[model samples]
Target: MSIQAASNSEKPPQEDNYQPPSSLSSLPDDVVLNCLARVPRSDDLNISCVSKTLRSLVRSPELCRLRSRLPKKSLYLFYHFHQDSKRCHWITLRRGEKMITSTHDYQVEQRSCSLAGLLTSPHFPTFYSSGVSVGSEIYFPDHGWPFPSTKVRVLDTRSGTIRMVPSMKVARWAHKKAMGVVDGKIYVIGGTYGKNQVEVLDPETQTWEFAGEEKVQCNSRFSAPLEDKVYMVDLEHGRISAYSPREGINNVATERLIEHMNCMCVVENVIYACFKRSGLMWFDTKLKVWRRLIDSGGKATLCSFNAGKMAEYEGKLAVFWTQINTNFVEKVDIRCRIIALDRVGEEIRGKIESSGSVATCSYSITLSHCLVVSD
Candidate 1:
């Protein structure tokens, strides 16, 4: 249903001179602002749809007082596609931006330069994967197994200047599986590194340090830079944990063990984690509890929602699945229909959207040693 229709159906009671309930009516504006800060980005939009008064309150810049407490701009990711044609292109998507749009394609000039320069070659998972930026450098690690021989390079995208940076001396660091930045340090976590180790890189000094071995089971996906913590998933066992440097780089298992967590993403401070077997796991940082999202599951087979390949787009959690037969990539936003936390797992709620070309082969792999760009 359209947002307008949904709002009209739940029209709030209107009193001639309605004073909201004493609880809400008497709340200081600042107190109300704190409540709004805890709401997920999508729910804030729903508040805009609820009523004129609420819409105004939620949209006001005054509500952003808590956002200023954040240390950095919400992370922006640019996924590059360097097809096998010796050409490279990129699309930049900021977490707060509305959409991902194609930009420009740059040519791969060197055969032995950084991995981004190897786009024209036929090595799979070369320059495509989720990555984060620290200072002027962006790191893209190999996503698949038997990690390719790569050289780490930092790029001045503006000047198209590429310079080699510190790389893991050991091979297959799972450099592509997941990456995050915390306290000015870069953490490269699990993929296919032999025995699974977390590789920490300091961009300021151009150096690399081996933090420790990854504890989660192999093939279990993990995500980092969620609030003050980095999360690791025991996918096969349905367990979860977070890493905090304040405590040490060691993985500290969470008291809440969620099963089958195949896909994970963070919005604001909460982690929206999805499991293939049990459905969606809603982790509230403030409450320190597990609220199962039951409404977002069930239709996975019909929706072609694989519990992998999810990305946050424009402040909404987008789940992506590839259709092999049609060579299509599809996405769904589960935020708009979230009525309660338990529904995150039980209902197949939200609008499903798809994009990209029919040819899946026309893709780019961002490698740890190379950068992938898409136009």
Candidate 2:
């Protein structure tokens, strides 16, 4: 009993079991990278917080190349259910590694995650062009949405600088599917009170001119461009045709395709459709018939479930679908699948590389419009 040394101030005893944490740096960069490559991307953000060394490693290009073990497709999804919950979901389609029970074979299970609230309500783009090839440069009217203007402003994707470009021949703009990019110019369908006139702008010369007066009338609100041709699908008219920018030929084909398909897209000069009943299908240009999609595991069940929309990403087919809960009071689940294609003569095989859920919303949302985008 050291009564003389027993002062009020005292420090807690150190636990002998405590030791400094191990560092990944202790391991070789290649070894660390190999271990990290197996980690789920969802956990990467958290792992980056562990140490400064890890932060650099996780964000490094080396990790990116390694993490890209399988097919990679970045998907942007917009769902408008209510004005209050105005948020956009960004989904990352990545490969997940899993070892089978006792076999050496590995399974790539895609856990599609939606990063919600990525965009605000005011800044959220009210884009109507379903087939527009809008690049990193975000273009809008000199004024904001719902306001018609001839002047167009573009935001530099790299610098994020917004500047006004030349005005169009027609003072027309709208959110109801009005704009499209063709060739090296911007074209405005210009939705001018019953007029079919379109104004074209050349970004290189900074000039605006009128396109052909006899524009093709398309019933589809969505369109997809294949090479030099812009393909439009008219479900009501039961027609899928390719609209030529310079010529009047639409190359109307697949009258039956529009009947079964709800959404369609083109990849590698091939038109693929999501049949309302048939899951996934692609049109045979030579035979003029629809073919089934095969999953990567050599299963035909890839398109067995109903899919909503189809888009091509990174030279692959991306399919989206929603299933209504039979117990109507529950939430609905919206999902997406990316399928890789291999064409051999008349037959096309679709291998589903990854799948994920985009959103979960209430069934009360009777009329919900989903717009899917990929880059």
lDDT values for all models: 0.47, 0.54
Per-residue CA lDDT of model 1 for 126-209, tens digit only, reads 333445556545565533344433344455544544555655654443423556678878766555533555667887787888
Candidate 2's C-alpha lDDT? 0.54
Candidate 2 lDDT, 186-274, residue by residue in tens: 66553444445556667677788777877544445445566666555553565555555577436456554544656666777887777
lDDT of 1 at 144: 34
By summed lDDT, the worst window of 10 consecutive residues in model 1 runs over 102-111
TM-score of 2: 0.56
lDDT score of residue 68 within candidate 1: 52
TM-score of each: 0.50, 0.56
